[model samples]
Target: MNPGSEVVVTLRRATAPDARPAADVWLRSFAAALPTVVSPRSADEVRDYFRDVVVPLREIWVADAGDDGGGVVGLMVINGDELSQLYLEPDWRGRGLGDRFVELAKERSPVGLELWTFQVNKPAHRFYERHGFVAVEFTDGSGNEEREPDVRYVWEPKP
Candidate 1:
């Protein structure tokens, strides 16, 4: 379904216990969103990362495309002031879920916000740019030596 024209996504606040399952979805959605191949994390590490990092900052949203068969199509992981992850299944991209998700996140974040996009993810870079996020910095080798550089974007919320 189209993001702006045809999807009815449901959103909810998640708890600490949700981090593992959510991160599981996050990793899968990440592979779906990007070309990178990644293995799933051990169950325990998933739980720990969620508890220590994902859950505490507390501005997260999970979405499902109306039908249960759609499974969880999206996951957004946010920190106190910045968005850490906003991933969706490929089928669900371009419908504007990413933009709406960030808006929801900005409502909860008390400070100006920022996000990092890999240089290779040109479509995503365009999506962020279209939504009024401006590139503030660039990093070398996509946060590592194997990939392209990372582009950082900043968003100053409207009053």
Candidate 2:
């Protein structure tokens, strides 16, 4: 059986009530997947970042698990043409939800979209590559919080 078969995810604009849950998903997924690539933050710190900063500053869309499970299973933060962040609950990985979010980002920014991921994050490289993103630049560990080498990817719609 397909992992995504039982779970139906629906995307929705995030509300105030979604801040905590969405932050929880982000914290857990980041802790599990990006220990070497991203800097660590306390759960409270992440919650505050979401509630006080991200929720107010960015256009965030959440992929909520429908009747199958419950609660937000994924999140995408889009700031203009940049997909600033995208994360899914560990349990929700390997489903089509990430692909859906990328499609939505493309739809939202038809001209192009750009994102950055740690160079060490091979899975992310593959995922973005499969979604039509191409690596455009590489940066040493100078600009980001984690101080890890990173790669920038951009997606342009086929004309």
TM-score winner among the candidates? 2
Give model 1's TM-score versus the native structure. Answer: 0.73
How close is every model to the real structure, measured as TM-score? 0.73, 0.92
Off by over 4 Å in 2: 1-5, 38-40, 66-68
Query: In model 2, which range of ten residues has the least summed lDDT?
Result: 1-10
Clashing pairs in 1: 3-95, 142-148
lDDT of 2 at 136: 93
Q: How many backbone clashes does candidate 1 have?
A: 2
Q: lDDT of each prediction vs. the true structure?
A: 0.72, 0.90
Q: What is the C-alpha local distance difference test score of candidate 2?
A: 0.90
Tell me the number of clashing residue pairs for each predicted model. 2, 0
lDDT by residue (tens digit), candidate 1, 19-78: 665776766665666656333465567657767877677677777665543746678877
Residue-level lDDT tens digits of model 2 in 1-159: 357667567999898889999999998888887876656566898899999989888999999886457689899999999999999999889988899999999989999999999998899999999999999999996988878899999999999
